[model samples]
Target chain A: MIQVKELLAILIASSLVSNVVLSQFLGLCPFLGVSKKIKTAAGMGGAVVFVITLSSAVAGCIYQYLLVPMNMEYMQTIVFILVIAALVQFVEMFLKKFVDSLYKALGVYLPLITTNCAVLGVALTNVQKEYGILAGTVNGFATALGFCIAIIILAGIREKTEYNDFPEAVKGMPMVLITAGLMAIAFCGFAVLN
Target chain B: MSKSLERLYNGLVKENPTLVLMLGMCPTLAVTTSAYNGLGMGLTTTAVLAMSNMIISMLRKVIPDKIRIPSFIVIIATFVTLMQLLLQAYMPDLYKSLGIYIPLIVVNCIILGRAEAYAYKNPVIPSLFDGIGMGLGFTVSLTLIGIVREFIGGCSFFGNELGWFAPVGIFKMAPGAFFVLALLCAIQNKIKIEGAKKGKDVSKIQSGCNSDCANCAIDCEKRIDDIEITQEDIDSTAKINAAAIEKELAAKGGEK
Candidate 1:
């Protein structure tokens, strides 16, 4: 039986201890790309949280119902990616029709989300962990939250760093990366929680 | 000959897949803990990239415009699955080292980026070379990052088992990946800055320039045009002034 406290711990651990960004390094593309501004970072974070959670749940269902029953597990990667691409397209169209402002804000990133590994990573990781529907959904949601928290923190820090004086060599991306390194080191302290 | 060479050279330095474009950071950071794993991952990706690019270029005409994205995903996924199976069957050690990243190659922006940007428009021969060039560029960058990280974090070069280097364990961890990537980006920026300082005439490098020069110039020119149109010369000056005065008074009263 999964206790509420255990679920909370899993959420905290996924967000801080085994962060997909700082720990596993699963989605550094968007981490570095969309992190220049906190607003955009938050938008990307929300989109990621929505995509990862939704895709993982869908992927888990498909894996459990179709692939596992038919013994066609080798097709998991292809199937998951196809599913993600379709989902991204659907989300993009839906947003454009119903939420024009959000569509304008996300703009290119909406399509680029198709290539973001974090969504696929969450799905594939759920399969690897062999979680049931509820567990997979919970893990997926928690992991997405974890990703959101990490990116938001990094974005906040990056916003502050942009104004600070630094060497020319380490001025832009290098300093952001160095700050990320320090954040990763700080997150490492959470390893003891497990 | 030089055209193809230019394409090849562009992938390596001018339009580096990783450092400049920032295309495949997931696997770049994940699998670069060791030099050997990095090389293996890089070569595997290159092989897949070349094969997929060739096929895409060969079939670019037949592919429907409506379903292009799905078609590309299928082609890329096929090659990635083939690579996964081949690695599992032949190079079990390297396969194990790369872990989930081998399969994660499907979503890698570099492979799909090339297929979409280069292969779709180019001929087969040039596309093949482009793939090889870009793949090699990506592989070299990943391997370099891996070597630096491994040497610092493990105190060994590709598991040398020698007692020569000092091991900083952070290099083997996630934080080490960030540190190395940051340093590499810094070095890359420094090189570009130095190249510019040397008067190399890198006007073509303006492709990724985020400096907003064009927009700024347009805005400045628009301001000058506005200044040139004095109140007496303007046809709607009275109407415009009345609207502006009313808006200013409204704002002042609203604040009060």
Candidate 2:
């Protein structure tokens, strides 16, 4: 049981110091693919936030109560993936029924979230770091927000680059990767703040 | 000489998972900060990929259709955890540097994508070769990127000090990563386009490894290997398209 202050620290650390995509490379697929369009980026970000938080919270508890007690901690990866896959399914249904607008924006990307790696990455990291339930959940939520921030910023940049006249060879994917490198350099500035 | 050898050739070049197929970008980018790190990650991934492909191929028929993806994930996660323990016990330094990536292999697209697209459908021998070919392809690209970054950024090649040009420093940084990878890709793309002008197939060297597995489409190139993707094979492979195919075959009565 972490205090409120420590929880905030974990959140900030995950969202910045160790960003899931930019620094850690946990969820580069959605980062590169969805970052092409702001709308899809936001939609995918929303789904990630939902699924990662819910799954991590549940995974933390399972690790704490079940795996720890049973000494089957080695099973963390398999167990967390199973939870995440199931949680993603539930979140998909919940979004379609309750948040119809979000449903449409993120409908196609929801299933993809199951295999996004970031979600499972968080769950496993939380276990590896030995964070308690509440702390792990906060870290997971913050990591997804970090992903959200990175993708939206990349999308905004990409949207502007659409009109520029890049060299023929450096036009599409190559240019985008170069842009990400620059963004990563800029983000590295945050390392000082920590 | 044989179909198995063709599969190996296809994986190494024709359908190189890293350079051409573009699967598993996360590790390719994050871990390639140093040549030694890159080689360690690449070899670890290769071992897991080869073993998992063999196991998955052997048990392909046993796994139920409705729960294939989850089952595959379970299998992959188990292998990854096993690798993690082995690495930690033997190579603690490498394991420490690799950190979370070792476990995150559970989500590496190459392993899952190959298991889904090739291993699950093909026989055990070819699938094993496909895994090796693809794994070797990934290792080669990763080591290449690692060598470039290490030499340019740190003034070393495979950890040996070169004592040559001044290390630019940024070449080892994240932006440098993007630059080197982009440079390689751009050159490959240029060659491919130029090759196409000569009526030569350059698809094999077109692009670098990209992770497109989480939401892979039915027509993903990885799925359609050198083995011509017939309608029946496509239907069996893609769950999303299976329904549509059922309705189509039902309506068309063996027409397509």
User: Fraction of the real A/B interface contacts present in each candidate?
Assistant: 0.61, 0.62
lDDT of each: 0.79, 0.82
Every candidate's DockQ is 0.47, 0.51
**The 10-residue segment with the lowest total lDDT in model 2 chain B:** B217-226
Q: Write the per-residue lDDT of candidate 2 for residues B1-256, one digit (tens) a residue.
A: 3978888788778777777766777888889999999999999998899989999999999999888888888888888999999999999999999888898888888888898888989889998888888888888889989998999899998889998989999887767877887787788778777898999976556353334354332222233232334676777778768888888889899675
Cα distance off (Å), candidate 2, residue B105: 1.0
RMSD, one per candidate, in order: 8.4, 7.5
> Which prediction has the highest lDDT against the true structure?
2
How do the residues A123-179 of candidate 1 rate in per-residue lDDT, one tens digit apiece?
888887777776677787888787788888988998877888887878877887888
Give the poorly placed runs of model 2, Cα more than 4 Å off.
A98-101, B203-256
Clash-forming residue pairs, model 1? none
Model 2 pairs whose backbones collide: B18-B209, B22-B209, B22-B210, B23-B210
